[model samples]
Target: MCNEVWLTSPNSNTYAQENDDHDAKSRVFCTKEDCEETFGMFLVKETMYLPERSYSELIRSSDTIRNARFKSVNWLITAHKRMNLWAATVFLAVNYLDRFISIARCRDWKSWMFDLLSVACLSIASKFNETNGHSLHDFQVDFVDTCFAPTLIQSMELTVLKTLAWRINSITPFSYIHILAQSVDDLTKRATELLLCVVLDHEFLEFKQCVVAMSAVRCALDQCVIKTSTKNVTFGHLETFIPQDQKDGMIECRRIMAKVIARDREILIRGKKSPATALKVDLYDFRNFSADDDSFLRTPEINVGSGKKRKREEE
Candidate 1:
């Protein structure tokens, strides 16, 4: 019941200047390979497993995937747009979906189940990531599926929350993507989209987020097919930024991602048909939106809890 800064707060004290300064200093000589190695070390404990729920049906093997597709990507991205969520939030939600399925051992998934999970994952991820996220009611407005009631979605959100073990503060490729994108600011958007696509498949889960991001950039560059070399900067130019030891892995990452892209190509095409270009989502919709009275869906804020408050609290 104490005063807390909502995660929605851009000025949340959780992100103090000290952390930023430390991160800035740490990345001075941090190559993508170093980032990948570091992430890979910790990724063993938690991360999205492969055969991504978005296109799980299409993938038969690491390299072999059917030409079919799923809207799990498009629907979630559209929801991301509609909810005015952070790009990272969408990725985290997808990661959550994959992880939840892996941990819960829930197979024999129904088609509509994917849609329901999409909504539930969106709500849960947004709540943890953005402080105040959309309610079941708000999501239904955009999704327009009445079969799964708001309460039902709320229940599913709890199930997802439990399945994730309340560890929603996941480390994603975006953690390193922002820093790497700085070197190639012009291609951030395109690179980020490619990163999203690659992560949708479980195949890339074995690799660290940093690796996926690097390979994604390669894939993005391949698609763009940029040839000009200003400052010797062409597509996949960042490959040099990786450590020599990890170079082969990076090369292979790019290769596997290529197949992931090929399999999801048609799905990606279909996903584009959604109203991705719609107007900006009005976040105020959730200002008073709640699934029920005293719902966990309505978190107070993204407070930087005092270290004294808990054994692991960073404050």
Candidate 2:
């Protein structure tokens, strides 16, 4: 307990590392009992998570998006890349928006709601996680052709806030991302991209977030090998980081994600869908409101499946 500010305040951020504070240089770690108790509390809290969609419900949509959730994931990933933001913040934003849609059972996946929801959720996510918050102008410019009035954006934010009961800090796959990953490099960035994809897929709902991140890490490292790994990362190098119990799940996720990536790559090679050729979810019975408003930005005819090959923009 030398020159250390003890875990003194109840209002202190539990999320911060004790060692991050210069004052805690010689502070003793809380004993095993404390660690176990904290972990157990986390496990109990995890049980409260709402599993929004089942495998059948996800695949059996009335619309013909053979992979409805998959497309949404792709959309989110592309938007994130175009914005040049942290992958995790984008993940957190999409997590909030997707979970809200699933929980609300808003079958209107094709509605204007989601477009607005995307803007609001990303702004909120940036506020929570980023040092600098995203502005309406930032969203408007980055999402060209999809322009919303500032008032409309604010209203939608309030609606999403209420719908989610203002729980913006809900647990996400990214929380455990650091545990499975060693370093943030090209391989890890690709892994995060894969992680974002799987998290949005209802097909992978059975697996936990940790399993998804671990699988992504495995898949990304494998891609690096094929693509000429700049970091020389290998699956075996990170194997010890994964828990023994999760190895099986990680393998299954790796297989599934690889297949997904392969399919996306095929699409990219063929060129992305033109705005006129965009596909909708199977259940596109009647649009309460067109999500395809002139205000909404449709997927551009760029290389959609470009994957990690798309060079990161200089920050």
Candidate 3:
């Protein structure tokens, strides 16, 4: 029964060919004024199609490309502070929550609602964390102002808290290790520090670049130690640190770091990756005390108007 229906369906080649021919003739007839006027009177139908130009052309244009580069540089210099930080925080929190809910459970109306609720909670938490004076009620008011109902806002806040906790738990181990290595006096620590200092000074702003430098360093150290007969178990006595192999991994790491830093700095200075921008308004309130300025004194003022005037004009 299904086979028979499939064979005689409108999707059949004969029916499709006839429909295509009819569509072509109608399109051709519509292009003519008399036929369009006659067709328009008979059929009061709306056209569904709209014309579109390719975005690739705009992206490829020199001015557009230059502007995009400038925008990227501006973002790096300002650390994306010109845009609403709250909006960005909310978006990031919501997106992460949505991903977590989608991955842990099936996508449905219930899941979507749960994700939204989670995002709101996390946003509130972040606001509270960032601004010590802000209360939960303040967050609630802000949420409502954004057009969310009280019930939805409350639910979202709960979900966001849970989602954030889960994400933190997953990355806690790696985060701890990364933090620990920074404070340690080991060779790995030194290598990592050099890598970080180089990369952080540049506009790349990615941990993966640091990882690549670390990997290259490790590989070079391993190759250098392979030639030596004595097995130095302690990191301090490693051959890479003492004699230093010309083809050592640490050398390669330093080279890579230098190259990345040099390239990124050039890009940044050229306004291709780090454009000049104003400091964040929120950061303006922060004050720094200088010990050197403690002994500085204000000189006594001599008022010109209060001084005795010469009697030359009267004479």
Candidate 4:
């Protein structure tokens, strides 16, 4: 075929484009049949990428770490929305950030370190989710006071990749949503939005990605967007995809998702500001402090013109 063919890989939910020669350098894609046959394997394999501890557990010991985690998540979310990238990108970026934080145990981490790490995670995520994503510098240009050089960002990216053993093909809630969507009608749009809402809140971190996906689907079904005669049957089939131990959490998660959806509705009716608005920070206010903060590094230079930036010694 001379034209472009867009195909969804069965192993993952992300799309891949194949040119006429079937070589557009896209992610390796499998057909729908492959997804169905190996869907069970995906469920079993998702646990490998999940964080050992929930977000709450990871930050329980330090208030500073808690604040940094919250702020980093918001920054990632804001950047994703600003860039108009896929929701999965931000979710994956946060997943990478959380996993790194959990394993690295960087209790002495500074705000600027989180900023740079967030950039690196987002850069990696954009590549995962977008076919024609922004450049590395494009991601750094929006940082507070410092623009990280390409090499610095690449170094951080490599650190993250190695930390996770190069397992960047994470199975997020979106992945399960993409898979389960095959069984039901119209599960993509609303379910995905609900999943995005859930991702923004750290509470969902405790639940498995499959559970979260099911909860999002149940929530979407409740929204009455999709008409189905065997809703319970559909749910039963979806339930089978989750592990036995996670089933209980799925019920509780669905309840929490209900509250979240209701709260979202109330915000719309009351015309209140979004939670995202509250999460926005005064980048300028912290710029000076972060610029001088050597906690994360000797410090990358402020220049964005070159690949390599000079590292200034601690004064």
Clashes of 3: 6
Candidate 2 Cα lDDT to native: 0.51
Q: Per-residue alpha-carbon lDDT of model 4 for 68-134, expressed as tens digits?
A: 7777776776677667777778888988988777766666666666777888888877775676758
Name the TM-score of candidate 2: 0.60
- Tell me the tens digit of each residue's lDDT in model 3 across 1-315: 101111112224534543443343234232234343423321221111100122223323434332332332232223322323332233233233323332223212222233234434344525432332332233332222133344444444433333333221111111111222222234333333333234223222112222333442443344333422223312222222222332254455555666664565454232233334311112221134232332111112211122222122110
Of candidate 2, the 10-residue stretch with the lowest lDDT total is 302-311
The 0-to-1 C-alpha lDDT of every candidate, in the order given, reads: 0.53, 0.51, 0.30, 0.62
In what order do the candidates fall by TM-score, top score first? 4, 2, 1, 3
- Per-residue error for 119 in candidate 4, Å, reads 0.6
Better of 2 and 3 by TM-score: 2
Query: Of the candidates shown, which would achieve the greatest TM-score relative to the real structure?
Result: 4
Q: Please list the residue runs of candidate 4 whose C-alpha ends up more than 4 Å from where it truly belongs after superposition.
A: 1-36, 141-144, 183-186, 226-235, 266-315
| Residues 1-315, model 1: lDDT tens digits | 012222222333433632443244235434756544444433442332232344343344312121111255556667776677788788878777665554443434434445566777777667656656455566556543234566657666665655454455556676556555545654566677777666555556556565777676656656664644323333254445455655767777888877877876754443455424211232333334344533332232212222111122111
- For model 2, residues 1-315, the per-residue Cα lDDT tens digits are 111121222223422432232122122324544333333333333333333544236445645332444454555566555566676677767667665555445453453345566777777666655555456666655343356666666656655555554445544565444433444466556666666545555656666565676677767666665543346433353444445666677778777888877765533221243112111323433334443343322223211122111222211
In terms of lDDT, model 1 sits at 0.53
TM-score, predicted candidate 3 vs. hidden true structure: 0.25
Q: Estimate each model's TM-score.
A: 0.58, 0.60, 0.25, 0.71
